[model samples]
Every structure is written in structure tokens, then in C-alpha cells.
Target: MLCPCRGKLKLLVVSLSFVILFTWLYLLVGNSENGRSLLLSACLVESTEARLLERDVLASRVREVEEENRQIRLQLSQSQGLAAQPVEGNYGNQQWVASADTGPEDAENTAEERANHSECSRSPTAEKCELIHVACVCAGHNASRDVVTLVKSILFHRRNPLHFHFITDTVANQILSTLFQSWMVPSVQVSFYDADELKSEVSWIPNKHYSGIYGLMKLTLTKALPSNLSKVIVLDTDITFATDIAELWAIFRKFTGNQKQVIGLVENQSDWYLGNLWKNHKPWPALGRGFNTGVILLYLERLRRIGWEQMWRLTAERELMSMLSTSLADQDIFNAFIKQNPVLVHQLPCFWNVQLSDHTRSEQCYTEVSDLKVIHWNSPKKLRVKNKHVEFFRNLYLTFLEYDGNLLRRELFGCPSQASSESTVLQHALEELDEDDQCYDFRRERIMVHRVHLYFLQYEYTPTDDGTDITLVAQLSMDRLQMLEAICKHWEGPISLALYMSDAEAQQFLRYAQASEVLKNRKNVGYHIVYKEGQFYPVNLVRNVALRNVNTPYVFLTDVDFLPMYGLYDYLRKSIVQLDMASTKKALVVPAFETLRYRLSFPKSKAELLSMLDMGTLYTFRYHVWTKGHAPTNYAKWRTATTPYKVEWEADFEPYVVVRRDCPEYDHRFVGFGWNKVSHIMELDAQEYDFIVLPNAFMIHMPHAPSFDISKFRSSPSYRYCLTTLKDEFHQDLSRKYGSAALKYLTAQRNI
Candidate 1:
């Protein structure tokens, strides 16, 4: 509607406005991009500076640590010089000039020497000499004997000092601790790590191996061992060393200059990883023949630095997604990791770990049996494996089995008189064993190295002039541990307990005792663990262990189920003095009784027990079933006599007694349920020890189910026949040991 000139002006204005708006938008977008770029660059620069500062700080700290270590090494060298002078006896051995004796200076030097010696001895980080570190995982009772044999072999050939690291359960730790503590080997040290602490790390991984989670514990050594320990030699319990472990330790040198090699392992001797052992065998992924984990040289520091925990965990997780469960546990995981990262493993000579499995092809590894350095009994059948050379290997294993651990304490050098003589004897014995085919029948009766784990938990026994200072020596299986608290509370004296159980039961019992209010706090109780070796319960063996550990002058030898009368400890104290027991070979019998009820009010005095007896509430222990067991106590005379009454020993007499600490040890051959206690009484009688019945002292046997051996004796004809044969053999042994006169107390048709 406007004129032509006005419309042209409006169109021009509109175009100008559009151009300005577009230019403004371009400027705003360009500025935003530039700001973002500048901000990112600033951030990058700041991050780089922070990282550089952190690196510099770390370098400074490392330098500080290195300087400190150098200073420590310098000080240690000076201290060693001071310590060596007095030990060498050089100054005393040499004739010194009189002027060399500067009195005050000499005193100061001696004081400094003593100070350095004390510091070196007490310092945790002091390294006076090189120590070969060995790691082992022993989890159960079955492994106790095998591990002992392994340790024996290691000590037998070790020329240098050793420091053993044991990853163990409570039971195995207890057993190993007792053995090593008693050995007291100079320049040897041992440390224990609880296997339970590392269980969670590998417990989630499904394993079908017979060893359960224990088999996987080795996988966690890098995490379980101390951060200070950099290298270790891991061994299975069933291995025996033929040569010095120093030879095996030297293999670590081959891994040097090879950063990728962190673990040294012997190749698997069998075709286990070939996936051709059986039909449909889908073994885990592995290199040709894989490698054995039984003997591993672990570079712990390198492993940790390279994140070995994460690597193995990830590998296990990925493989588990495809497989149902691992067949060989940690060994499978190890092989799988090596297959993927072959550079991480350094293969050792097969002679180092000569696996002796049923399907073993390890014979090709060694030209002669002497070439084998380490023997691994990888099969469940042990010495009974199908190998043609089983006898030779069996003999070698038996040599360690029969080895005396005490001989290991002999000094290696310096003491020429005794140490050299004993060392020669040991060397000659070993040489003779090596020269002969010393393999004997596996079934032949022989002496075992029993009394292994003595006083796993010990009470310091302090003797008193009072007669109350008595120790109750008792034997029981783990299930019977429930009676411990009641007896300990009532007796008020020291107690030595011999527990016969498998490794698992011993662990369970330790846990149970820790949770117990009375037992955990008890300071007068000793626990000795006896591993269940054979099918039969070693009842006499358990008794001997308990008796041997009693430190009190008087020991009341009794069973765990029997609870002594109140004031019995005090009564025995007074009775010992009154009866002048110190000068006499006498055993004071504490007549034992039993009740049918599961729970009853225990008698506080002999009067109350007699009342219970007259009221038909209690009967003498095994009175109705086996009269001879307690008939020798002479209960009829005990009822009226205020003083002790002499009782003649009879066959099958087994009465609980308060005897001197030097009482005869029980016959270990009388195992299982029958004649174990009776044999002890027979031996006591043969030794001319008098049995006197205590009128006031008594013990009450609580009702419980019969033991497995007792049930077997009642149910199995073969068991009864074996017991009868053992009894006959025992009589013959007794006759041979004591004389024909020792058999005069035996009565024909006697109940046994």
C-alpha cells in the first residue's frame, strides 16, 4: 500500500538487521569455543604439574629410605665386628702384652660389645646371616606326618639357616609349633599365618579338588606373606628333599635379568593338562604339559608390583564363566595363567619335582634314581603307587619317617668333642640308609614318631608343699571335651589333657575352647593333640602322652568323663604327707562309680557319695558288666577303713589312682578300647608298686555313649578276635620284659 520508495527503504532495513543478527550469533559461539579450549589447556597444565610434584616427592622418600638402609647396614657391620670378637674368644686365647690392658677403656669396649649383642639379638629386622625362606601350607591332621617328614628331609640336608613360613589352620599350627619348639634347632626360625584369613580371597572360586579351599590357599601367598619377605620356596607337605634345599634356592638366580619371569616351577610330569587323560576330559587351558605347583619359587615382591592378585582373580573369574569348577584348584589356575602369559614363568628341571602319581611319566626326567632331588607323592595311594621304582622311593621316605628329630639339634661345627661325634653318627646312619634297600613291609608293626604335638597349650606347673598340687592326667576324643570344664572346675588343680582327634576336630576344639568362659581363662590346663593315625583309637598312647607331660609330683590318672569328689585335691595333698607317699612306691586308688542319669548333683564329700551309693543311685564303674575292672579296689574294706587299705593286683584291674609322677608308662601296643588301662595296672604290679585304696577320695563317671572302638568290639567278631590276639601277645611281651613271675597274677577265664 505504501509508495515504491518507502518499500525499498523497508526492505533494505530488514536485510541490514538480519546480517547484524547473524554476525552477533557467530561472535558469541566463537568466544565460547575459545574459552572452553583455554580452560582445558589450563587444567592439563595444572594436572601435569601436580603429577610431577608427586613423583618428585616419591623420589625424595625413596632416597631417604635408601640412605636409612645404608646407615643401618653400616651400623650392623660395626656391631657384627664387636659381637664376633667375644664369641671367637680371640683376645682370651692369645697372649696379650700387659700394656694392652687399659682398664677403663677395656670396660667401655666390653660394655659396648654387650650393648650391641643385646640390640642385635632383640632387633626384629636384624639379619646376622643369610636365611633361606621356605613356605608350606599344612591344613589338616592327615598332613601332619607328611609335613613332619618333609621338615625332617629339609633339616637333614640344609647346610644353611632356614626360616619356615607356615600357612596353617589352628590344628596344624598347634602341631607344627610343638614339634619345632621342641627341636630347638639353632639358626632356624618359624612363623605361622592363619589360612582362614586368606580364605575369602579365593573362597568364591569353585573348586572340586579333594583338598577343598586349602588347596587354593597357595594362590594367595603373595597377599598372605609379610610385606618384608620378597622371595620364598613353597613346598607341598608330601615332598621329600634328597639334596640340600640351597640347591633348589639357587634356581632363583636363573630368573634374574628376566623381568617377565616371576615364578619358577617344574613342568608337570603327567599328561594331566593334555586333555587326553580320560574320555570327555576338558582340562583347563594350559601350555604343553603345564607345570607343577607342588614346588614353586615365588618372587613375592615382583608379583605384588605386577598386580598378581588381580591377574589371577580375573583369570579365574573369566575361566569360571565357561567351566563349571576347577578340578585341581590353585594348580589349574596357575597353569591357566602361565598359558596366557608364558613369559611370567621360568620352567625348572623336572628332577627338582619328580611327581610320583599313579599316571606319572616322570621317569623320563632323570637318568638315575639318584638324580631325583625332590620326591612328590602326588597320588592318594602314597607309597603304594603303581610305579616300578616305588620300593626305592618308599625306602627313602621311610628313612625320614624313622629319623630322630633330636639329632637335628647337634651343632654343625666348633664343638669337636660332642657335636662332631653326634654329627658323625647321624651322617653314618644316613649313609647306611642310602646304601641299603631298607624298605620294610608297610603292615609290619613299628615304632612311629609319636608324641609330636605335646603341650600345644601349656600351663606352668608350680609345685607346692601342700598335697593339693596334683595334676590330673586324662585322655579323650574331641567329643568328650564337654566334660573338661566340669572336671577342671571341681578339681582345682593342674590338668594335662591328651586329645585324640583329626586335624579338623582339633581346630574346632580350639575354636570352641576360645569361646568357652571357663576353659579359655583357665591357666592350669595343658592341651596335647594326638593325631588319629589308624582305624583304632590309640588309647594307651594318649594316656602315655598325658602322663609324660605332668609336672606335678602327684598325678591322678583318670578318664575325662570321671569327675573327682569335692576337696579331692586338698585331700590328696594332706594324704600324701600323712601317708609319707614320697618314700613309698604306692598308688592311692580313687574308687570310681557311675550313674544311669545323664545329669545329677555331684557329691561334695565321701559321706554324700556313700549315701548315693546306699540309695542305689550309683554303682561302681563297670561293676555289673565287668567286675574285675574295679573289684581290686576292695570296696567292702574301703567302706569302714579310715586309713588306706592294701589291695592285691588282679587280672583286668584298672582303677583310677593318685600315683607319683614317675609311674610306669602305659603299653602303647594296647590300642583301641580293650586292655589299655588294665595293661598299665599289670605293669605297675610287675614293678612291685603297691595299690592302696583311699577311703575318702572318689571319682564319679558320667553317663555317655560308648566310644567307636567299644562299639566295634561289641559288634564285630574280627575286632574281638584281634583284641584277644593282642592280649596274648601282650602277655608274652610282659613275660619277656619282666619275667615269668610277672604272670602269676593272671587268672584264667578272667573278664577282659
Candidate 2:
């Protein structure tokens, strides 16, 4: 048993057991403080597997973005190429023929004075060429005609020597050159550039609405023009000049070198890009904002030195092109580049580029018949039948076209035959407009509610065959049950009341209903109380629920505080009976009036309310009148002469509209206060269901002290949150279902 090998093995086993036991004891004690902290540190660092997974996800995203970028670049590249050079038209090269005997020699002093004007001299570059360089793009025959008209307007207003740089096709270039040469004014020098020369450079730019190749011509102004020009004003073909070219040229002095405002432009004015582009993309510096490129002031040398073309190429390479949501081609490209470099642009006032989409005209540009410096007909030009504003601008454009060649004749002599003809045409157009004044009047006719007695009201009262078949729906709190009680007492015939309330209020109202004689045992009256716990007046939803509960064909949507005037029920019953099923499809809207707030007793009848109104004891608030509620354009006249008028698309709160259940139901999206019941009104309007406002019958709105706790709901967080959600949803839903018709009404209200 005492062999050498066996003794050695036994020693080794005992040594290993001792080592394992010691190691276990050390780990157990270390786990309390420093060891525990070390363990947490290890856990905090991501595991190898987790780290790998995260890296993989990030790599995938990069690849996706890269792929999208590559696709857009490919698209942009594919569109680049030179358009074929245009062929010359039938009009061959025609030499300059003087239409006026008076030459530049005769007006040399005047020309020199205008060229040396302070406005031109004050600019950084005062190289006197006696030229006001104005650049425009005219690619087609129609565009060439517009350019002629524009040039005439420019020349007629300014005595200063003018140089027109026209970017056009071969035919337009030839035609326009010939037309300008005929002007025979030595102060005017007309030059032309075939856009095809620059086509290879901007071939990558695709068409987007009006921003196609023609739109992109100004972007490449530096390379397309002679290097001697210091600054140039680029204009759209659709625009007409209202002020002199010299005034527009004066803006060059404001573009300082320190500011590095290489381009001067005005904001787009309309929220088109702001809503579509800016909202989707993150905003940049204060100066980096949306602008309309229709009118621009280009410092030619600065743009060339900046290597704008190279910067544009860099933008494409960086894959910034993918950020665009179509309809914003060149505009998006320009903005993206400017956003990266904010100092390159100077924001001009909105007047410089007066867009047709703008709701109002320029106050600055309103001098005599031509106050605005530039009129940009970007929109409202598509319609043949235009509003008065559009008509005026249209006539102005036509007048310029009519007097395109007459300006030279007038400069030599007195007012020529052409001038008289233009006046005649304008006078005729204006007279036609004068005859159609009512058609052009956009002012909303005000609604007036005059107090009148029951005898003044038109009452065709015959008892209904089915006695009291209408159901009245109201949402109420326990405190306002007395008003409901009053309505029940005064309203004749049978009307089932569907009251929406909270659980606690419902319990209290049920008790009151049991105690009251009018509500307790009357078989004709039904108290249908709907209760929800913790509900903060879901106005439309409650109305919808109540609407479903209604058993009768006709439903009256009213508030608890509404006390119907004398003979209302009788008149309503007879009116409902007289109408056929086809006529009953439309709602019967009875206008409601409010009594004095401090008055304890409600007006017993319309007669009493009228008497109080005349005696100056009670005043009708502004809200009591039956307005063209949330309408874009007023359709029907005010109901001064009419007893009842059908409104296709308007409704008010506590509207007293008796509609069939099948009509467009209340939109449940609307919540408290502001947009409360307007959704239902708009929906009914969109569905072509007319709401007839009844002057014959009305209801009294019994007033109380301003309830701060309740009225303040409009500004409350809950109300605002709900309102934002509902408003967006309402517009989207209507727009999706009914297109622009629904959108028109939804935007008209702007209830949110």
C-alpha cells in the first residue's frame, strides 16, 4: 500500500480539493462590494451577440438609404441631355426698320441722364454700358408673344436704356428679335440666347408642374450670359411688368458683399411648400426659408465665383435629390442647397414677387392702374371664367399685347390710333364688368335677426295624423334639468325626450322625472336617459347615440336650455305632415334666439321676447342671428323677405334642425366647444341635404351667467388636444370621400 506512484496520486488529489474550496470562499465574500460592482460593469457592456445585431441593423439602414439615393441619382442623370435646336420659322431675318422718325440722337441727353442715374451709380459695379439688363425665358411662340407684351410694358414705363436678355428657342429668338428691332428705340437693345445651348447642362432636371427646363433657365444664367454683366433680374414668362425696370434694378444696391446675398427673392406667400416640404424636412437657419423663384435678382459674378453648378452637382451626389416630394423639382433642389449654406440668399418683401395665389393684392404696387412692380400670374390663370381680380389682370395683359408696337408711334407723335383702340378695348371690358358687379361682389351678406310676434309669423297649423311623432334629443347635466322641465311643459303634442347625461346626473334626472307630473305618468312623453361615466360631453357621439334611439321618422337636435316659442310644435307638426317623403329628406332648421342673461324667467312666447327687445329690456346677442354658418361663399340672400330658405351646407349649435335619421349622421370626431357640432353640419351639407331655416317658427335660448368652469373648456388641454385630432381627421375624411367640395367647406369653417 505504500508504493511510490500511489502515494504521489493521493497527494495531487488532496492539493486540487483544497484549491477548489479556497476559490469558492473568496468569490462568496467578494460578491458583497467590489466584486458586485465589477459584475454590474460587465453586464452594462453589450454582449457580443447584441453588439453584432445592432451593427447589422445600422448597416442595413445605411444600405437602404444608399440604394434610394442611387435610384434618384440615376433618374436625375437620365433626364440630362441637349434638346434639339429649333428650326427657324417662315419669318426670315428682317433688318431694323424705323417706325418713328425720332432717333436716339434726338434723345441722347435723356438717355445719358437715365444711364447715369443715382440708382445705377450707387451699385458696387458702375460700369456704364447704358443698359438695364433684364433676362427672361421665352421658349415657345406663345411665350414669345408674352415676352413682347412684357418688353412693351417695360419700355413704356422707363426712359432708361434697357437690354433684354431673352432665353428662347430658334423660332422665338428670331421672332422676338424682329419684333424688338421694329420698336426702333435706340435706348432698347434686345439680345437672344437659344436655350438649347444650356440644355446639356440642365438635362438632368426633370419636369415638375411649371418648373421644367424653361423654369431652370435662370439657374444657369452665369454660364449662358456674357461675363461683363454685373447683375441681372430673371423673370418668369407668365409675369407682366407693372413698374419700371430701373426700380427693380435698384434692388441690386441693397445686396451687400458682406452679407453674401448672391440672390434676392421673395417668400412664396402661399403655404404650398411650407406645408408640403418644410413640414416633412427639418428647418435650418433663420434665413434659410421657402422662396418663389419666379422673380430673382442674380449677381452674375458672385454666382459664377461660387461655382453654383458644382454645388448643384454636389447636392445630387450627396443624394439630397431623394428628399423631394414631386411638384417641387428645381424649387426643392435650390432650397436644399441654400439650407446647407444660409448666407447666399437675401429675403425680399412679398411685394417683389406678387403671386396670383395670394389672397390679397399688393398695397405698395397699387399706384394708378399699375402700382405693383411685378404681377406673377402663377395661378388663377387656368380658368377661362375668372373673378374680377383675375379679369383685371387678364385685361391688363391683353392691353399690353394690343399696344406692343404702338409705344414707338406714341413716343414720336401724340396718342396714336393704337392708344385710342387700347383705351376702347379696356373701357369696353370695364363696362362689361360694371354691368356684372353683383357677379363679382365677394362680400358676405350679413344676417340680421329682427324681433317679431307670433301673429307676424307664418303659421299653417293643422294637427298631425300621427300625434307628436317627433323625438327631441338633448344632452344635459343635473343642474340644467329645470330648463328641460320648462321645455316639456310648453311644447304641445307628444315628443319623446332623449337626454344624454353622466351616471350621477342621470340618476338625479330620473328622480326628478319620477316626481314631476308632466314626465311621471304621461304615456305620450318618454324619458330616454343615456348615461356614461367620466365622459366630458362627447357632443356628436351623444347626439349620434340619441339619434339611433329615436323611434320617430323626424328627429329634433336641440339643447336642454332651448325653450320653443308659442305655436312652434303646432307649426312644426303641420309642416312635417305637409312635406312629401322627398321633401322630408332635407332638415327643417328653426332659428333660435337668446334672452337676457340676468332674467330669472324664460320668455313665455316670441311675442313677449319681441316686446322686451323693443322696450330695450332685453338685447339679442350677436350669436343669435342665423348666419351663413361656416360657408366659403354665400349662396342664398338673407331671409328678410322669405319665411324659409334651404341652406345646402351650413349649421349652428342647438340648430333646431329636424332631419330624417337616414341623412348624413353626426360625425363623432367633433368634441367640446369650438368645433362641437360643425362636423355634422358639414357632413349634411356635403351630402346635398339642404337645411331649411324657418323664420316662421323659432326657440328661445334661456340664458344664465357665464359658466367659467364650462366655457373655459375651449382653452383647456383636453379640449385643445381633442380639437387638433378631430380637425385633422375631419378634413382628411371629408377630403378623401368628397374631394374638394368637402375640403372647401371644412377649410371655410377653420373651427380649430
Give TM-scores for every candidate, taking all chains together and pairing residue i with residue i.
0.48, 0.36
Task: Please provide, for model 2 over 534-637, each residue's C-alpha lDDT reduced to its tens digit, 9 standing for 90 to 100.
Answer: 22444555555456645566767777777777667677766676654335467787665566664545556556666676776554433443343423112223
lDDT of each: 0.75, 0.55
Residue 493 deviation, candidate 2, in Å? 82
Measured by lDDT, the strongest candidate is 1
431-463 in candidate 1: lDDT tens per residue?
A: 444233322111111133343476555345567
Error of 2 at 523 (Å): 81
Which candidate has the highest TM-score of all? 1
Model 2: lDDT equals 0.55
CA error at residue 446 for candidate 1, angstroms: 28
